[model samples]
Target: MTHPGKPLIEVVNLEKDYPAGAGVLQALRGVSLSIAEGEFVAIMGASGSGKSTFMNLLGCLDRPTRGSYHLDGQDVSRLSSDQLAALRNREIGFVFQGFNLLPKLSALDNVALPLMYAGTGREARRRQAQAVLERVGLGERSHHTPLQLSGGQQQRVAIARALVTHPRIIFADEPTGNLDSETSRQVMDFFSQLNREEGITLVLVTHEADIAAYARRRIRFQDGRVVEDVAQAEVAA
Candidate 1:
């Protein structure tokens, strides 16, 4: 998990553009940075600040229109669509504000979805999913549906789903947005625990400063560019 000086993500002159009527809207302007393995980073900005776009590119959910991205020493910008999909699935896990769980599936099944897509056998998938659910303190809830769980429990399930694949990195976008203040604290505490104990690299995106305070380093964006990047003391619970 810890690679000393090795960077898990490196981008040079990263840029992204969107087409507007009769013109182009530049969402990112030559942003460049590197994130080391086992580091915890937070990306912060207001609406239209381009942090979301930057995260999309970093998460391998979207490609940059200009500039190069190197992930784990591989130039992802040069990969074909299928290759990119495969790499993303193998290297990254995603947690979202919406939970994004299937309504009809049990918690275990929802957590095992990535394994299912990766062609894991039914029994093996169930076993792995149940293990991860237990790791997240949801072992007894594996048979419950999302609708039956509390918001915090649902988020824990999402986190379990992200961890089931044993990915090298996790990308979380507003993961605590839907939870109550106390629940948000609990979720953030869990994230911090993962970073400190397991050394799982984490990149989180949020507009709230309190949420960003949970991270060891903070990167702030303004008008499509990173205005600041600094290391800070993490909030100790």
Candidate 2:
């Protein structure tokens, strides 16, 4: 069952800027958003709309330039890099467009890497990795390397790796960018199942309309700000 009234993510007056040749480019303009526990949301925008910056912030890959970010009731804006890394390892799971699987390692090893980094015992890590791989429908492919699997299978392995740690939330950035429509649908279905069954919050970043459709809510960004926040009923028809 989904946890009630738990605010998994909260961003207040967040901003990000980059130093250009002669001027500073503002990527995020004081954007604020709140994501509840077990909610499935998608952030959508064009190439320069700051959605990518938002994703980086949401995944704890980068800190905001100004303002505060609270993740799971902890103030994350003030954390040091190492501290943030530790928090990310324990709280956030990431799925990327390219799968990001180690080319030479088997799927099981790749999935077990995070557990190893967290100092879990070898046998325990293997067991947890195997369980997650099975959940993602890749248990039979656990012995295969990235080069040995199809695109969809590789993505499933990546998803398994992300879930093995049992994070509070999963952040997926253009996760289906490299897959065909059918494969993309399969991956999205798997994500939906995770959210509904396991009560894991899912935040997806995508530019594709069909891909975003799978999310319960959609936030649209433009020129470094959110222009629209719509529920599924508002945009689905």
List per-prediction Cα lDDT, in the order shown.
0.92, 0.89
- Among residues 3 or more apart in sequence or in different chains, the pairs in candidate 1 whose N, CA or C atoms overlap within 3 Å are none
Native-structure RMSD, model 1? 1.9
* Candidate 2 clash pair list: none
User: Candidate 1: which stretches are off by over 4 Å?
Assistant: 1-4
lDDT (10s digit) by residue, model 2, range 144-186: 9999999999999989988888998999999999999899988
Tell me the lDDT of candidate 2: 0.89
- After TM-score superposition, the amount by which residue 114's alpha carbon in candidate 2 deviates from its true location, in angstroms, is 0.7
Q: In model 1, what lDDT does residue 205 have? A: 97
* All-Cα superposition RMSD per candidate: 1.9, 2.6
C-alpha root-mean-square deviation, candidate 2: 2.6
What TM-score goes with each of the models?
0.97, 0.95
